[model samples]
Target: MRMSMTDLEPSRVEPEERVVILDFGSQYGHLIARRVRELGVYSVVLPHHAPLAEILRHRPRGVILSGGPASVYEPGAPQCDPGLWQAGVPVLGICYGMQLMVHQLGGRVDRADHREYGPATLEVEEPGRLLAGLGPRVDVWMSHGDRVDALPPGFTVLARTAGSPYAAVEGGDGRWLGVQFHPEVAHTPRGREILANFLYRVCGCKGGWSMAEFVERAVPALRRQLAGARALCALSGGVDSAVAAALVHRAIGPRLICVFVDTGLLREGEVEEVRSIFTGLGMDLRVVDARDRFLAALDGLADPEAKRKAVGETFIRVFEEEARRLEAQVGAIPFLVQGTTYPDVIESGGGAAATIKSHHNVGGLPADLEFQLVEPLRDLFKDEVREVGRRLGLPPAIVDRQPFPGPGLAIRMIGPVTAERLQRLRACDRIVREEIRRAGLEDRLWQAFAVLTGTPTVGVMGDRRTYGEAVAVRAVTSDDGMTADWARLPYEVLDRIARRLANEVEGVNRVVYDVTSKPPATIEWE
Candidate 1:
């Protein structure tokens, strides 16, 4: 892929233009980063103990200390570089973070008389910089045992809850603030507003970063990196891959070959639909029908991780084969593009959590691969990817379709993946998709899929006893596929999906709706 002089121009950002969060291994560290991004300013998370020199290199406009489980007084607890506050950067601290600030700055902290776990009320003593526009009294999410007993020499009370006298405080320096409540999570009514106040007012950020700006930078960077080398993209037609492919295609033009891998486990007509969308938009497309290859490899692997690995390896093999075939025609395909997102990596053991499972691109790739991955959306979340897609002028239908796993229906098929089960699932899934679209709620959901539960249920079909597979319909609304809540689809829409699955699909005897959230149950059953 080659770019003209105009296309190759570099993108730049001024130092001191972004926010950074020092993660003390808080369960909510990523949430804090996401909240900052939602405010239209860039933010990043670093270990609480990250080098002050490294932190200063970003020339951050502001820094935030994420709440953690450790007590400030405990030995070996994560310690911040005291120079962080001394760096002349604005700082805000969350729950345990608040305690750490006070403890390190010469104030006392010990076990609280009454610990606040879930929710609490904060009464404002003074509307500090962080709490500028928020009213006198506001509800906040709190979870901590250690409380700040006294103010640091430069600190004064801003707000307090029943359990702690210094729930929120501001240092004599206008740049420092602390709150013993989680303002990152949605549970706090004015969490976003309070954070916005710190980000815009205290930090002096102009707040305009977005996925559009991201694409504007990425296209040029990819162009420079690839520098006329051939690229092969695994286009899954999902938001991530599509957006990734579109971005690379923009950078390299004809040098980018997009292959839509037909994993056979996909929903009915997905291959044709994807082909039409990309081809219509002028993408150089190659359709590989590898359904048999994928299904054969998934013969008896019941474990979800096994299935994910098998499918991921099979994907690499197919791409490697395609790369060899194209080698004679378009040089070497040095870079392989897959639309892998950050949350997927984090959930798959990239960030804080232990290994959940191998996200096909992150952990599931075969040890031997033909090309380096070009995942433009690796650091972005799902919603962010969608915005990038929209910026690239992809079809709304292609960009709006809720995400599907890279392993396809193999992961969605809980029991065993077979041609028969796949077909049955495809039929039920089609009904679910059609009904959701007909109800005009398709865009309202993050993802809605049909899963084939292993166990079969007995039912009387036209007076004859029949036993068939049970199916579960899952729909959720999530921002970045991080934390999700099950979509409260209208019962009338659910009724249509259930009725059609029971009558027309001919496979499912019972239909169940999954109401569980992500913590207890993932969006995909497998």
Candidate 2:
């Protein structure tokens, strides 16, 4: 594999500029980081109370206070560390972040009689430095019940809406800016442009944070981290793990062992594809045939969550056994590498409640295990991981693999998993993937999976009434798995998938497409 110039760059070398986002438990906190990345600048989402020393360690060029589900007047509402205001970096606050900024700086906020929860028109009262390029009047997305009644001593209200008296504020010679509306969402018109203005004008940040640079910088650090340490990576054949395994291989060569477990719930041909890719990469590889183990452990499990937990726990037990055996032979315990990404960490919320999903990496680990964890892709999002994969010279087939749940087909099968049901769903899912690929839409989707609804529905085939399981094809496009919009598959593509699944896959009499986005419906029904 040929190495790109960017791949040779030092990973620890900080970017020319970065945006630090102080997360306040808002769902959009990660979205704020995504927006900054889209602007060609690196961003990290830290907890609201992250110490000033930790923030300074990143040497961020600017800071962003993310919106949250908190009211400034609430007694226990999240607050920023006092040292943040004096951090000397340009700061932009959104929604609750704005309210917190005001309240912290000696301003007053109150619950309003009329609350804005959707689209609103902001009339610019004063075109301050923050609103220099943004026009006089614009539309923005608003979702808040509280409003700032007054600004801090030196801060001036930059804009206001019908219901909000202090919709926007600027302070500290434009070093500090706050907006009552979210600029990260597309619904807010001119949001990206506004963010760009902040990046270039306010922060004076250089747009050097590209995936190319990331891969170049990360490789050597990954090499050092794995030096003299044998590593075992979980290869799910999905893009995340594939990229992770490939990158680690590039960094440490034979010291890295890629383990691909056949969970029996994977779609048709998935195991072979994973094996072929790892072998092709010339890395030490192990293909564990644990299909029966997974199926037996999951036998009679009807609840989706239960099936998921069972699959996760089973994987860890199997992996732990393998790790111990490998260690016994190799005379040293290896680092257990996982493809855990930022979205997983953020959605899991860095706390107990967020850790509900039995992540095979952290959640599934037994308390008695002793191997150290190695997660190279911990800081990257899914898209960035793919770019790094491409830079590492991995095959497009592996690098562009769609997102698959760790529980595999277990979660996709809505009821008790059975060999017959697995076959039916795999066939249906293959048809959907083939159709999407033929339409040249593979790269446009984050995930495209088929689910066996388990419930039999009445249908007619060959003029005969039949009852069989229903299959629903779900495809979504998302920057991060935190939020997603259902992909709008072309009618022809949908028609082809549905027709093929019904006609080709046995026990599937109905085929449907999931049109619901995240929130009302998660990407995975289970």
In angstroms, the error of model 1 at 439 is: 1.6
Judging by lDDT against the true structure, name the best candidate.
Answer: 1
**Residue 301 deviation, candidate 1, in Å?**
1.1
Give each prediction's root-mean-square deviation over alpha carbons. 4.2, 5.0
Q: Backbone clash tally for model 1?
A: 1
Angstrom error of the Cα, residue 275, model 1: value is 0.8
lDDT of each residue in 110-149, candidate 1, tens digit only = 9988778888899998996788878889999988888888
In model 2, pairs of residues that clash are 6-216, 7-216, 9-217, 10-217, 11-217
| Residue pairs in candidate 1 whose N, alpha carbon or C atoms collide under 3 angstroms | 1-228
Residue-pair clashes per candidate, as listed? 1, 5
Judging by TM-score against the true structure, name the best candidate: 1
